[model samples]
Target: MHFLKAATIAILSPLVSATCTPWSTPGTCTATSSSCDFYTCLESKSGCGPTGYELGYALPFCNAITAVSSNLSVNGQAWYSATKLCLQNALSVEASCETSCTNIYLNAFASHVPCYLDSGFCELSGADLKVFFQVVGVAGVTSNDGLALFGAVLQGCVTKYQNGQVNMGWTKWLVRTLNGEI
Candidate 1:
């Protein structure tokens, strides 16, 4: 049910259909001709605007371990709460970072504690997001050092969609799965 609701929201949001187009001057070209025109120029280029678009990730208060066998995963409501707060904060920080740093690749990231029996280290050591982001020249950071390395892996995943790589989001995935569409 929770997944269903999230899926609904994701489907409704305009963010999914949003696409970046290049800038062009008026009277650039005509509709019937192959010559340059506003519409044609827009179609040829797909890059962010001068300020660039912002990307954010909300950290859900999910348990470090999701146990399918025992169905003992953390509460989805609590996880969503943390995710909302974390994503908002991440966007804020990203805006600031973009303003302060040159060549700032605008991306949002978050790292949170998981409620697993074992220490987070033992449970999360295998996260592979770092390698993903390293290929793109971005590093993911977490508020907690212990979560930093692992956090990068998550950020790596997030960055994978940087410049609009994926058409669907986590919420969409959940909805599709729940609807027997996956």
Candidate 2:
């Protein structure tokens, strides 16, 4: 009886104690203590999270998005390649349909829209893209619903330029806001 009980407990313990790999989007780690915090590995140099555990989109580490967009407008054009792509995409979509699409959904009526064709220019040059990156990338930092806030800021800047409202220092402000530098 003792031997049988021991074996049963041993088998069940592993099952009962199984911990979750990574945390959810809001970044909740709801696993037993046995499970490790995926970020810990980054410090310890153990290994990057296995598949679907790197961070965004819940894809596997191997397949996850390793790079994020670094769109910045400095002198009449995008400073980063990704920013240029964003500009192209925005222009393409705008030409097809004058409506803007947030990376995440928000109140459309309240959201601002750029009236002019140079919305992306305003966003890149005005906002501090680097700051925006830090704010969004920081773990456990809930500045303003993360993605939603970012989308709103982006929308606002884009709308301003589109509406021909570009002015002194507006581009700088937009870049800082978008990058989380501010």
Candidate 3:
């Protein structure tokens, strides 16, 4: 009986190991890139954008911004600084970093909506507004030609999060917002 039990354990070990694949970490920006382009990094399959299950780990927009800032050229650094400033100002206006704000900007670009001009949404004036537009233009968010490039993936994540199929940090916020609790 002991021998039979040992044989069964040995036989099942390899099968279990083979069947259970480990989770892979998402890719980040390359340190050797000539120029740091946020859109390219965000949209690339193996770049800063997290696909499927990886979305539960961190906010994709923030991740991409961090990755792109890792190794930036002089011009890239300038753009990064302006972008950070614009993002900070925007966040101060009740916009959430973990929510769909980033994607909304991208979507606005697709919908031909000048988000900066939306006083109710932007609320930025003068220099801040100018910088905001500059950053948005440089990030290529306004030049997408009406394509919701990341819409499908973002929608899938939202659906999965709403259904409790994923454990993202923003799930509670999303749920409350959807239920009109916020």
Candidate 4:
């Protein structure tokens, strides 16, 4: 009887502890998995980038964001929507200009830092928060920690732009446009 119980436990252990790999393709993972956070699993195995910008990255990321946010409270949905828009716009700009536009893209996206911090994004916990940081490439940070990281990066961009270490005329225009000030 003892030997049988040990064998059964060993047989089931791997199934119970299995971790889902981050999604490489849509529909590969779903929220039903008890051990997987859907959003964390949406992080691209091939990475989101200027190279395969659309089909490979933006579409997958935005789709996952939309899917998850659809199930959240209204405030949470708004937060995710804003985040999606920011990335979409920034990535579009980067794709158009390649590496030359990287800083501008970063700064333009960073301009939304305040909004992300103040919005329902800060209210996220558990899986939602995990998803947020996973997309940010540093999975498992608290909302405060994530916002701090954004703030630090934004501050760095501001200092660099101020010191004339980087050019950002286009970024200024992009930020203005995004804010509806244009």
Q: In terms of TM-score, which candidate is strongest?
A: 4
On residues 1-182, what C-alpha lDDT tens digit does candidate 1 reach at each position?
A: 22233334334643655333323333221222111132222223323344322211111111121112123223332333344344333333222221322112222221222211111212112222122223223333333332453444334434433434433445235335656999
User: What's each prediction's TM-score?
Assistant: 0.22, 0.22, 0.24, 0.35
After superposition, the stretches of candidate 2 with alpha carbons farther than 4 Å from their true spots are 1-127, 138-144, 167-182
The weakest ten consecutive residues by lDDT in model 1 span 57-66
- The TM-score of predicted model 2 comes to 0.22
Per-residue C-alpha lDDT of model 3 across residues 1-182, encoded as one tens digit per residue = 22233334435634763222221334442322223342332334323244321232223443554554535444444544544334333322112212233332332222222111121112222343344334334444423321232232234445666666655344445556777999
RMSD of each: 18.5, 20.9, 18.7, 19.2
Number of the candidate with higher TM-score, 1 or 3: 3
lDDT of 4 at 36: 23
Q: Whose TM-score is higher: candidate 1's or candidate 4's?
A: 4
Model 1: per-residue Cα lDDT at residue 43: 23
- Show model 1 residue runs off by greater than 4 Å: 1-74, 93-107, 110-182
Write the residue-wise lDDT of candidate 2 on 1-182 in tens digits.
Answer: 22233334434544763333332223222221122232232212212234211222212211211233223234422333333233223222122222212211121111112221233434443345454344336541343343433454556665664566755466546656677989
lDDT of 1 at 29: 19
Candidate 1 TM-score, true structure as reference:
0.22
